[model samples]
Target: MKKVVVTGVGIVSPLGIGKQANWDGVTSGRSGIGPISLFEPDEGLITKFAGEIPEFDATHWLSKPEARRYDRFLHVALAAGLEAVEDSGLVIDDSNAQRVATILGVGLGGMPFLEETIGQRIATRKLRRVSPFFIPGLIANMAPGLLSIYTGARGESWTATSACASANHAIGASLRALRSGACDVALTGGAEAVVCHTTIAGFNAMKALSTRNDDPATASRPFDSGRDGFVLGEGAAVLVLETEEHAQARGATVYAEVAGFGATADAHHITAPRPDGDGAVQAMSMALQDGGLAREQVGYINAHGTSTPANDKMETAAIRTLFGDHAERLAVSSTKSMTGHLLGAAAAVEAVFSVMALQQGILPPTINQFASDPECDLDYIPHQARKAEVEVALSNSLGFGGTNAAVAFRSAR
Candidate 1:
């Protein structure tokens, strides 16, 4: 099997626009969640706050015409993907364009666009009034399709849609492509922009979002007794991945090795994780076994702590089941407590944080830890960041439909 490595990463998160900005925010325990300013909430809407990138202007990264044609999701995807390629310093010219792949994960694409178009069509009572770009603009696969056209990389281009676990699946597929010699380089991650009426209303109906409109910053209290629900977040992230030999031949700087990936289905529930956390335990165990790592070697875990009662307790139980005595020693944290939940893009951004943690020897903090939940007992690196040497890190993403995925990374040094 070919050794895969992560050469570059790009982030368009609520924390900030770029990688450095997000790092600073997480390390400083700053929360990016706030009031919902994108649209005025109706009187009946329960959750009015979200982790939105209010300062993100599409014109800054895309031309006016291009910005006008696509949805917000595509704009963020292209921006992050281009930034990743530029960071990697990998020239995709005629010599190696065919060996590069673009793959991304997206859960709900262009909900705002769909809502607007449907409204306009209903109001006018004319189906032909819809814009020609409506279908292409809202489809999930267009993210990677447009990226391939923009970067001129033709190896394989596609999108993975698995709800919240979408990004981890995309990264896992990229690992397979590199290992099988299908592609020497891959731009893989996830993008999502669903901070709109339909998404909010749907989640609100399901009671899946936090209703702490008064204090939005402290709403995402993962593993805390006061945690009500998760805060919806919007963003995109891209990681430049390549085989070890291919990266070394080009002298690209390696941040961490893409050691292994593991995915499983709970076969238990639609939205709720198994109470015993059997599926999560299996996913993490498989990830460690695939990476040839001992359970004790994993120093950090970026948990799938969504600030929900069921998820937090289940994930904690899963960790305890998998690592046993070593679970207490692990430095665990949930960046979601600060950045909110970015839906499908959550795992990708978490993966970037995990890599950064390995490189900098600093553990990002899980803020808003007011009161702890006894069932969810762990270090959690609460309230403030901690400086520590971490040799191996694991990022876990558990999504809807009982999907669970984990990706492991090792320090390049």
Candidate 2:
């Protein structure tokens, strides 16, 4: 298999609009959660708190006419993809455009726009009133399609959806494609912008959102005893993945190696994780084996700690099962404590965080961990950042449908 490496990364997250800003905020232990401003919600909708990316001006990133046709998800993906391509320094000319593919992961694509269109149709009873771009804007695959069109990429382009694990799966799949000589380069990541009234109400009704409306910043307390549930967040994250030989030939800076990827299904439940964390453990072990590394080699972990009661404890248990004694010494932290849950986009951003940790030798913190829980007993690196020499890092992402993925990254020496 061809060696794969990440040459560039771009992010449009709740913390900030670009890679630098988002990383700075995450390392500094800043919280992006705030009062909802996207739309008005009723009292029962639980719209008071969310990790919203504030003041995102699509027109600034895209042309006015293009911005109007695409949905917010596509706009964010295109903006981030452009940034990643520019950062990678690989020119996508006509000669090699056909060898460049785009794979994006999205959970709820154009959900708000679809809801608005349905509402208008019901109110006006005129199906023709909908814009011609409605269908293109609402499809999940449109994010990658728009990217391919904008970049003149004529290779395979599609969207992968596995709930929150969507981005990890997409990135892993893209790496496989490059390794197999199917594509020379790939743009892979995930984007989401589903923070709307109906979505919020649905999560609220399911009791799956934090109710800390009065204190938005402290709402997403991962591994904390007082935690209730996850706070919804929105954004996009993209990475430039290429074979090591290709990147070296082009003199591109290699961030880290895409060492291994493991995916598993619980086959147990739809919304909740397995009680014994069997799927998570299997995924982690498989990733380690595939990376050709032992358990002790992993220096840090970017946990999928969604600030939920079940997920935090279950993930901790899974880690302990796989790492054994090394679990206690390994530095584990959940960036979600600061960024909240981006759903489909969560894993891609967290994977970026893992690679950054391996590169910079710093572990991001799981902020808002006021009181530790006995169930989640590990070095969470709570409430503050830690400087450590990290050579290998693991990022875990679990989704709603019992789908779990674990990715391992090694520093480029």
Candidate that scores best on TM-score: 1
Strongest candidate by lDDT: 1
* Candidate 1 wrongly placed segments (more than 4 Å): none
Q: What tens-digit string does per-residue lDDT give for candidate 1 at 83-135?
A: 89998999999999999999899988999888886766877787866888889
My TM-score estimates for the predictions, one after another, are 0.98, 0.98
Indicate the residue-level lDDT of 278 in model 1: 90
> lDDT of model 2 at residue 160?
91
Q: lDDT per residue, candidate 2, 1-413, as tens digits? A: 78889999988888998889988999999999998888776676764778888689889877898787777888788878888888898898889898898999898889777777666686788876678888987799998998888888888999999999999899889878998899989999899888887678888887889999989999999999999999999999989999999899899999899988889999999899998999999988888887787888899999999998999999999999889999988999999888989988899899889888888888999999888899999999988899998878999999999999988998896
* Clash count, predicted structure 1: 0
Q: C-alpha displacement of 224 in model 1, angstroms?
A: 0.5
